[model samples]
Target: MDPEILKFKILVLGDSGTGKTSIVRRIIRDEFSLVHSATVGVDFSVKVLNIAQGLEIRLQLWDLAGQDRFNHLSRLYYKQASGVLLVCDETKPDSLDSIVKWKGELDARLQYKIPAVLLVNKTDLIDDEDEGFSEDDLEKICSRLRIGSWSRTSAKDGFGVNECIKALVWDILSDKESKTPDPLTKTKDVFDWDDDCSSSIIRLGRQDLDLANSRGRARKCCH
Candidate 1:
């Protein structure tokens, strides 16, 4: 018997040139485009992920435009969001500052906080000899924003891309399980965290079903 499939919307919000689109492409298609143009409004792609094995989740990834001109339309995309990836470019210090605005807009439009993970992108640009954003600094920011988890990723090389998806998806599932009224069903919630790599390895969230990833055509909007 086939298990019921659930649909979820994951919003990727960040400033211009923060590699929001690249992150999505890396996770969904495992491909990255260096010459990708800036998003005019909102561009989105779809991917169906099999969780544990029993639960199938359709992730509608919405990459919102970062330009101020398109800010007025942000509310339309924030509706019914299941999770959020608040992205920022690690090499560009200014990109970190822009995260505040993105979060502010999300709060104003959604009127409530949704489960989110902060993606510090472009980690490859940082010097291997030098450190960027100390652990204390990152902890302070995440704590202030109430982020569930964070990862240092390199969309260009696919360093932490898989971790990003796993973390956010786990949060979404945990959130849903807490709200579920059925006490008969048990949620498999055991996961191991790698502090050095800052990623999660889910071991027990298994199901008796087939898992697959679907590549769906995406729609782009230009203003």
Candidate 2:
């Protein structure tokens, strides 16, 4: 059976030092970097990801530079973006606000909202005494931004990295099924960040990816 092909432009936005590039490397290249070289302006990567049985997603992952100086350049990449991943650093709480601003900027530029998810990276440096983003904290933001889901990740260890991408892609697919709301539209406001949080992986069907590119077509929003 031929699986349906879908191509999507997914923007990865976050403040510098939040490990956006590292996460991108882990996903697109299956590698991680120890050096913290910042993304110059905008970096692009692509992967054919498996979302479900008989369904594959050609993800054009755009890793936008987090430097404030590149704000204008970053907004240019938001045009016709299918979804967004707002990466934030666990240690640097201020980055969370930046993620909010980035989301707002994306909507303002695109003239509409698309599915957005949060990836709180740097989980490998866990501090037990530190208070992380609580349910109330997430609820308020999720309600306002309409973020579909969020999860803790460690780009260094490759933990929950793939799950984060899968979650957002799944949300994009749901938005296309009908104008009516579905489970994907519902706020999955929270995900367990504990050691057992591996369960967060999207369980659309069989896992992993292998499909034809052919400029995949299912719900690509951009021309």
State which candidate has the highest TM-score: 1
- Count clashing residue pairs in model 2: 0
Which stretch of 10 consecutive residues in model 2 shows the poorest summed lDDT?
Answer: 209-218
Predicted structure 2: lDDT: 0.69
| Clash pairs for candidate 1 | none
Q: What is the lDDT of residue 137 in candidate 1?
A: 58
Model 1 lDDT, residue 161, Cα? 67
What RMSD value applies to candidate 1? 9.5
Writing each residue's lDDT as its tens digit, candidate 2 over 1-223 gives 8866778999998888999999988887777879767889899998764433345558888998877788778557987899988898878879888878887878778976788877878877866634555545655666677777667778998877776776676567667654555543222322312233234233332232111112221111221
Alpha-carbon lDDT, every model: 0.71, 0.69
* Off by more than 4 A, model 1: 129-131, 183-186, 189-223
lDDT string for model 1 (154-220, tens) is: 8999876676677677667778877788721424533332234312222223331111222111101
